[model samples]
Target: MVTSLLTFLSLTAFPPAGDHYSSTDSGRVRLASELAWESGRLSGNQYALLTNSSSQRLFNLADSLIKTERAAVFFSPEHGFGTNLPDGVHSTDEQYKGRPVVSLYGNKKKPLTSDFGVADTLLIDIQEVGLRWYTYLSTIRYCLESAAMAGIPVIILDRPNPLGGLISEGPIPDSTLMSFVGALPVPVRYGLTVGELFTMAQHQNWFPLMKDLKLTVIRMDGWKRSMLWPSTGLDWIPPSPNLPTFQSLYWYSGTCLFEGTNLSEGRGTDLPFRWTGAPWLNPADSILFNQSGIRVQYDEKTPVSIPGRAHKPKYENERLPGFTMKSITGDRSVLQSIRQVILSLQSAGRPLTIKPYLFQLLGSRSVEETEEEMKALNDFRIESRLYHFYP
Candidate 1:
């Protein structure tokens, strides 16, 4: 394939990948001279793979490529072509700038390359929200698998995980609960950049063809371990519909648990996932609620101990008051503390009954069982620290 393309076109067009180039402190560089070699010799149909978060890199890379190569096919995820699709809006494929825009989301997720009829190289540049529950990761996994099967090389433009790269939380998904959402067994906060995550996935031999595929990761230049999302010096565009800010990212890893329950995950309000409520909660019940949303309930299954007081087992109503939304942070300390609050609510007799599909988000039943497993999580964290990608 490589030789045929070169034969069809002049051999001087494409530049070798090994040429080293450096960027300034901002990681921006002037276009290389070789890019001008093949200004306009071929038909325009090759594709650049990008999701909402990594879409910015598209223009940067395209500026250099269009100087020589033809225009590219663009692939998008759940938020649709331009990422303007609202929370649950149904999206359709369309054309932009004479190039076809393909939707990798909606009912069918696999790359419809056959449908497109002629896109060879698929460049992927999606932003991951750094949570297991987020759908973008699954979209990438599917794209990778399909691209490998079709013998397409994937170039991944890397970006930072907003929750930092040091911590891993939540439980690994069990085989039984696996879905598009939980494509692999990484923790809810598996702290690797999308490029590195693909590296780990390929190394583990998960996708057979993907293992041998030609994957090039354009890693972020100055990204460090402690630099949170705001520190990146880039604009913060929400990668998905509900995840608007870092606060939403923080509450999402835990509060996403609400998807399995009867209460609203705050979808209708300005703050989804971060502020949860039901019409059942009123000012009359506010006094019993805790700062972290846990309120005591009297049920019969589990009992509690106190000073001359054996409190009856109960369902604790977790009231997520407003402005606590502002307090959201996806830090390990914050996650662990939130985990304690959720498990405590579970131990208090409200054993969370998850939806069949949502079990993938929480990882597994082993992750859901309240009292014993939570303690095990602490132990797991210590052991998992060895796999830590960042400090």
Candidate 2:
């Protein structure tokens, strides 16, 4: 059945529209939130905003709505309104500029009809890191479900996928593995902007409420599928507290898998997701690199308790020998390198244990099997392209 779907997609998929950078000017990319506010799209409606600190760097959508009396209640995703809270930390309801700020993380992942208060619309403007495991995608899905249930429309202020929209990696997750981290069946690097992703979901019937949900995506002006964060001419705002730099986000696709393992995935350190190490990790086992354009260096680092970032991270206060990875060409898959690292550690007589959380992160039990499934996702990729707003 899957083979037939792939073959059909291969025959009917839309042809490439050529490279966006070749024809269009790659100046400062204008955000959809700024465009919506400048125009009358964000006016007159008492809307609730699902946003974080990342959305405020260019234009403060929350502030603009509040000042105009269009904001009814404020909603925050995984990291709270400020985006300063640590991972897994529960965000409480609070007051933001005299407005009720409700957290979409923690106990309540979705909003109730009453949570909307006197709002008629829901405005979402959070910046996404272009990975499935990032909780923002799940939050967006929940918001859509809630909006559909409440009969309110959702206006998504689109942002650029920091990793660009070209290369997708890893497997389309199994349905049984659906969680907050792996909400939908998209690959690890799904390669779609948040708006594009939700649009694909709604069109493809990924969720039941998607068909009933009224969604309006305010598209960006100059973003291209080929342009990464650096190419977009926008400042790097840490979507989360740990991903402070573009370099950290670059290697996050693979290194984020370290979070499920026994090793410290660079949490509580200066560079999270870019560094992975443990006390048991042998220095000799670190010589593992199968993927080209990836450089690894051996280093020693200790995880410490940084308030609001990584409070009591794994292996905290313990100096461990580990390697830091740097991408030379920025196109190679770090997933292969990390997989090889796991194999090498096991080969060197290290008692490495794979946890159940690893399956949740990878969306499958075996990395090799997931890679095989990823190869057969031509149909899914082509179907995704049908909803692409940009070239």
Best by lDDT: 2
List pairs with backbone clashes in candidate 1.
49-123, 293-318, 297-314, 299-313, 299-314
Output the lDDT of residue 82, model 1: 66
The TM-score values for the models, in the order shown, are: 0.72, 0.91
Q: Name the TM-score of candidate 1.
A: 0.72
- The number of clashing residue pairs in each candidate reads 5, 0
Clashing pairs in 2: none
> What tens digits encode model 1's per-residue C-alpha lDDT throughout 226-305?
76777767666767656667767767777776666644555545565566554344444323235444332321121122
Q: Write model 2 residue lDDT over 109-149, tens digit each, in one string.
A: 99998999999999888898998999988998898899899
Q: TM-score of the candidate numbered 2? A: 0.91
Model 1: CA > 4 A from native: 1-21, 26-45, 57-69, 115-117, 282-323, 326-339, 346-354, 366-391
Q: What is the C-alpha RMSD of each candidate to the true structure, in Å?
A: 11.3, 4.4
